[model samples]
Target: MTTQTQTAVIDQLSKHRTVRFFKDEPVSDDVVHTILNAARQSPTSSNRQTYSIMVVRNPETKKKLAVLAGNQKHVETCPVFFAFCADLSRLDVACEMHGEKHVKGLESTLVSTVDAALVGMSVNTAVESLGMGAVMIGGMRNHPKQVAELLGFPNGVYVVFGMCIGWPEWDKVPNVKPRLDESVIIHHEQYNTSSPVPQIEAYNQTMADYYGKERNLHESAWSGPLANQLKSPRRENLRSELESLGFVFK
Candidate 1:
C-alpha cells in the first residue's frame, strides 16, 4: 500500500463512494463512448459477451426510468443513465444464423448476469477516473417488468442493474463507506472457519462512527439493518417475473 507501489486505479478504487447528488452538467458522447469501449474489454465467459448496455439521455425517458427505479431522483437528474442488461437475445440470433438453437438454463442465467456486473464495474471505474461520479441502481429490480417495458427490452434480456453518471455535487457526496475487516472477509489458503462475530462487532462500531449523530444509527450499525432486511424475503416476485421474461434459473 506504499505510495511508490500504489497504482492510480487502486487509488481511485480506494476512494470510491456512491454519489447520489449530481451537478447539472451533461456527460459528452465522446466520454461515454470511451468509457464503454474500455469497459467492453472486460473479460467475458467464453467470449460470449452476453450483455447489452442501454444508454439513456432522453429527459422524459429518464423520468420514467426514475419512477421505475423507486423514484430515485439521481436517475432522472444524472446526465446519463446506463442499464446493464443480462442479454441472451443476441445469442439466440447468433445461434439461429448457425442453424442451431440457443439453450437457456441456470448456468446461462448466472453467466450473463456476472458478465453484466463485470462490465458495469469497469464502467464505474472508468467514469470515476475521468473525474465524474456514478452510482449503481439496484432499484432497477424493484419493478423489473415495468422497467423492461419502459426501456423496450426484448424477452431474452433483462436489466441486471442500472447506473447514473454525472458530475458530482461535491457538497452532497458522502464519505467512502467502510467495508468488513479483511480477516472476516478474505479467507486464507483454506477457508477460515473461525468465528467472525468479533470482527463484525468491531465493524458495527466502525460503521456507527461513520454514520455519526447526523444519521443516528449508533447501536445498530451494519449488521442490524441487514438482518432486518433479510428477515423476510425481499423481491418476492423477481423469479416469476424473470421467468416470464425468458430467464431460466433451473
Candidate 2:
C-alpha cells in the first residue's frame, strides 16, 4: 500500500470511521488465536508481560458491558470482545511464590498499564491486518468498578479497557479521517510552539466535514468540542479504583 514495505505498513493504518460490519461473516477462533499470538509476542518492559487479555463470548456479559459503556450496541453485537487488563496481582503472586513480599508500587502499576495499552494496540494491528473489523472501547473506564465487579476481577487486577472485534459490514467500510498536519504533531529534537492553534483549527474543520459525511449527521468542529470537555464528567476513577483493588499507584 506504499512505495516501500515500511511505508506500506503505515499505509495500512485505519483512520476515521473505519469498519463496523462484515456482511454476515464471523471471525474464526484460529484467526483470533493468531492475532493474540502476535500481540503476546510484542516487546514488553523488562519482559514482565504484566498484562492479560480476557475474551468475552457470553451474551449476558456483552449485554452488561454494553450498558456499562453507555448503551453502545456495537459493543454487544461485535462477534468477539476482549478486555485488556493492567494486572498487578499476577506480579504479586509471582513475587510471593519466590518468598518475597509484593514490592510493587506506582512504577509497577505504570508499567502494567503501559503494557496493557501497548498489547491492546498490538492486537488491533494484528487483527486489522487479517481483514477483520475492530474498534477500541476506552469507555470501559467510565465505570471501572462496575466492570471489574462484573468480570470478577481479583484484588490486584482491573480492566484498563475493552475492544469490539468482528467482521466489517460490506456497506460500512469507512473512509480515512482527516488528521492534523505533520508540522503540528511531529517536533524535532525539542518541542516547538510556533503556533499549532491555527493548524488545530484547520484540522478540526476537516474532522467536522468527515463526521458529517461519515455518519450523515451534522456535527461541530474541534474548537467547539474542545470547549465542551469542560462541561463533561470524567469517570476516570480507574486509578482510585485500582488502589482500592490493592494496587499501589504511588
Candidate 3:
C-alpha cells in the first residue's frame, strides 16, 4: 500500500517563512475584507471575542509606527499594518449595559491576549495562503503607552503585537528559518524532564550551517545568543506600563 501525502494545510504551514521585505504593491480592500472575515472565525475564549485589529494604511501613521517599533522598516513599507489589540473596553461597556460592575484582573488580561494571538495567527495563515507574505512585529510592546496614545486607543486596550503584510520582494526573501527539533519541543503524553543540552547542541550546529550560508555566521546559533539576550531583563518596564493601561496582574 502507498502512504498518503500530508494535507495541504500541513504543507503550507511547514513552508512558513518571515518576509521582512515587500514589493511596492497594494493589497486591495476586498482582499483585506476576505482575510478578516476568515480570520474572525478563529476560536475565542468563552465567545468573548476580546480582541481588536487596527488596520493602518496611511503613510504618515505607518512612518510613526515604524519609529515606535524600533525602526522596523517593514512596518512602514508593508501595504498594510495590523495592530492586534487585547481589548477589554467592549466588555466593560457590556457590563455597564447590564448594570454590572466590570472587573479587571489577570484572567481577563490573559484571555484577551491569547484571543489576540490566535486571531493574528489566523490572519498570517490566510495571508500566506493567498500568496502574500507577512511578518509579526513584537516590538510593538517596546513602548506600549506611546503606541496607545499614537493610535488613540481607549483605556483597557493595548496592542499585543503588530503584523506587516504585503506582496513579497521575492528576490530579497530569506530561506525558511529552522526551529527546535521535535525531541526538544515535543514530549510523549507527560512532560519530559530530561536535559535538552544535547538536542540544543545538535540544533545549534544545524543552524550554523543554515546561517553560515545566509548570514555568514558560524557561531553557536541557538543557545549562545539566547543566553546573552536573557542575561538582562528585556522590556523591564512592561509590567508597570501595562498596569498603567488598566491591565491587572494580581
Residues 61-133 of candidate 3 have per-residue lDDT tens digits of 9999999999999999999999999999999999999999889899999999999999999999999999999
As a whole number from 0 to 100, the lDDT of residue 105 in candidate 3 is: 94
List model 2 lDDT by residue over 1-250, tens digit each: 4556556447667342445553456677888888999799887899998888999978899999989988888788888889999888777788989999888788888888899999998888877777676788888887878888999988777778888888777577768767788998899999987978889878887878877887764566766776898687676676687778777867
Scored against the true structure, residue 17 in model 3 reaches a CA lDDT of: 92
What value of lDDT does candidate 3 attain over all alpha carbons? Answer: 0.94
Query: Please, what is the TM-score per model?
Result: 0.96, 0.90, 0.97
> Residue 84's C-alpha lDDT in candidate 2?
95
- Per-residue error (Å), model 2, residue 186: 0.8
- The residue-by-residue lDDT of candidate 1 on 25-46, one tens digit each, is 8789999999999999999999
- Sorted by lDDT (best first), the order is 3, 1, 2
Taking all chains together, the TM-score of candidate 2 against the true structure is 0.90
Among all candidates shown, the one with the greatest lDDT: 3
Which residues of candidate 2, in runs, are more than 4 Å off? Answer: 1-8, 14-17, 216-218, 231-233
Q: Rank the candidates by TM-score, best first.
A: 3, 1, 2
* lDDT for model 1: 0.92
